[model samples]
Target: DGGGVRGLSSLLILENLMHRLSPEKDILPCNVFRLIGGTSTGGIIAIMLGRLGMSVKDCITAYHSLSRDIFDGPWRPKAWQTSKKVLGLTGDAELRSRRLEEAICHIIARYLPAEEKSALFGEEEIDPCKTPICRVFVVATQQSNGRRVILRNYPIPYEASRDMTIVEACLATSAAPFVFAPLTAGPEGCRETYIDGGLGNNNPVAIVLQESRLLWPRQSVKSLVSIGTGARVPTEVKQNLMSLAKKVAEMIVDAANEARDFESNIRLTEPSIHSVYFRLDVAESMARIGLAEWRMLGAIAQRTRSWIFENHDLLNRCVVTLGGILLNCLCITLRYLSKC
Candidate 1:
């Protein structure tokens, strides 16, 4: 749950599978899945895929382009550009956060048609009818109630303003403390500030499952897949915030596991794949940021590749078993008829 680029690994794994399954560039099989939910970096990916309806390949490329801006500093104002700053102040954390949010919104806008953007952004809530994907949710916590806020295309509650922008929602979900400032939604005085939803619900499998149940109450979810960056145990204990962060990490892992098990127990059919990388550590080290991104992403690709192979094998075995059962049933019926 450490706020780093490692979370992108989830998308990488999904992209790898799509690449192997089809050689086609712009077409992907993700349309089979109805609802999409994510937190932090994953939340950004979800907005791109589930909200904007961009192909997986395009999403991957767009993320790659934004990664440098996100990880490095992309919001630095040019020395001559005084208007970009507040009272000649530059390098402010909040300003940079806003810039990054704008960059992301720009990326989201680029993928959508001109007609769609006006409808999607012009309103307080996205017009779900205009979106190519049915439902998209990005998790963010309500600062006041400590409620896990699932930001959807749907309208906000009656008390809150109807004009909660898409850019604001995503920035709130992805904002990591110390890295980015907490974001506010709704009007001043009554506005709620939100932090990273990962603190409340890191893996958003439950949201997707809840939607599925609503859509098809009598049927079980056919498959539920989750991808996570690897977790690492604290090597040496530190006091205060660092110590709290470690404890929170442990809590997140436990909660995520419990959520996964809970889903499995209730579902008529079990999920096929749930991958968590416990070996990789992105949160532990803050320095050498560039190197960390490379190593973590490299490990994710290698590990995800193995998962892809294993799942492919499992699918093949299922096909063979079904074929054999069908053949045996046909042969038995033919012999009984001949004897009669």
Candidate 2:
């Protein structure tokens, strides 16, 4: 059923199937990963799954989203052809660029399972021609170490992008590409195929699955997945999302325990579209993670900062906008509280 694209990424359809087709079925045993493709549902489902020791490979990477030719790479076919381009791959621009990105994907691929190549770009049946907003963000992850790693910028091969250093990327980019977890309330069964991709839509189901981390999916598991595909522009709504994301990031600095690494401490994978997209919804995001609510966490000292520096970026460099930060913080606090 999960072919490579948008494979079973729909929570709504899944729930519908569960509710109408066979409400008595339990999917928890399937080891089946579902991407909620949103804020609230996906996020919370991941939270619960984390407690179960299941690892989520999130599709919604922080600041990455590109239609790379992931197949058999000489690499950077276009970036290399351009006058201005990335450096240091030892070949011509195209060869270098292609090799570079391919190398990167390869490097990360090493740590990931063979099945999670497009963790975020999980694939879907959505119509790519949709008139709605099409998103391809740099997928971000909330590792078990309390870090939000930008999947694309991971430094196994080299430590920088064409624009800046890894550190800079982490700081600046962490604020934008938000992570999402999907979930569902009431549901039912579905056809052998469900979660149909809307044609002329940017909301690719693959991206949604990638975002949901339903199959042991992580926070926005692999790449930046699209939320939906529609022509209607609710400008006010878009502005609100930007504002909300920004505010959550600002509050993150003082809200958590010692900063986390790219690998979040509590890793989780949400299942189903309804669950995944629901978590991403701003209201649900806030209500479930409580990242919007600022509390005094007693600023972690500069020594901690220096420790990070001393490690030459080896120790911890992960950061979640505000949502992951607060979630990790509360988890950290609870850990100590229990120990005490």
Candidate 3:
């Protein structure tokens, strides 16, 4: 579920599944989940759903609106060229900070009023507890030492609070190294830059499992479900790489490999967990950002219903299955290979 833009496909499928649960409306009640953890785009959806209490439709609308601007809007990479050059930190070196500001603005626009933007991103420190949602964890990576920074109900110093807004923190977690600038969050004195949480935990289901155990030690996990973007890798490798194609191939290989591993490991250890992965027409929908993509999401959503019908026992006996399947190392391989 953590393949850059491809992750949106998973979110779309999730929206549909939520609708199926209620059938009448898109709202997923808070009781449905004990805790939620996400990486990158997954984190964005989790925050809106868990913290902001936005409906599935609201989340979908917001993401669709931002899709176009992601590559060409003010927050687009290198969009802050002038600022970077004037600051004497020219080239792509300063693109991270520039894109960071743009991402912050985009988030502020999504969650806050125009008047509140300045105050939210300003010097005044706001308490995290005041936020509506607290049972959410955003996984991020610490650049200096490559630590997995789980952003949840942690203590923050005055300076860190001043510099980091919830939007900024989420953006920091979503910032893919090299693709987007690494973020300098935490206390002002702390030099560790935070990057995409995907570097460490793309599936992030483990975060939910581990944190749930810590928070409610006595309660056994009731049900566990995960939705992914298939996370399939191509079996064929092109022997020839010419110029830019080589770099692109490398990036592709890295993502496909990571995604494959994530799905494979989850299936082996957690078979009872109902996992839905979008496998049809993934490549066509990956870079797209429009109604067409939305339709594709709808298609994937329908497929989930079919999957559920086919695997009734998996959902009904999720808890029992989890216990029994603990030692089952069968890797549920994906049927389709995505071009991500």
Q: Who wins the TM-score comparison?
A: 1
The local distance difference test score of each candidate is: 0.55, 0.25, 0.52
lDDT of 1 at 213: 65
> Which residues of candidate 3, in runs, are more than 4 Å off?
29-31, 73-134, 154-164, 235-340
| Model 2 Cα lDDT, one tens digit per residue, 106-139 | 4345444455323332223333232111222232
The most accurate candidate by lDDT is 1
The true-versus-predicted C-alpha distance at residue 52 of model 1, in Å, is 0.7
lDDT of 1 at 84: 31
Ranking by lDDT: 1, 3, 2
Go through the candidates in order and give the clash count of each.
1, 120, 1
Model 1 TM-score (2 dp)? 0.67
Predicted candidate 1 versus true structure: per-residue lDDT over 212-279, tens digit per residue = 66545776434455555544433455565545554444454333454546555555444332221111
Task: Please give, for residues 1-340, the per-residue lDDT of candidate 3 as tens digits.
Answer: 3555455565665554455455664445232454666787677667666655566677667665544345433333333532343344434534544644565466556665555433222333334324322366677788778788777633233323234566766676776654556777656575567877877576676677677777667766555555554444333455543323433423432334444565577688866432532222233223333211333444544554555566455444443433332222112111111211
Better of 2 and 3 by lDDT: 3
lDDT of 3 at 182: 71
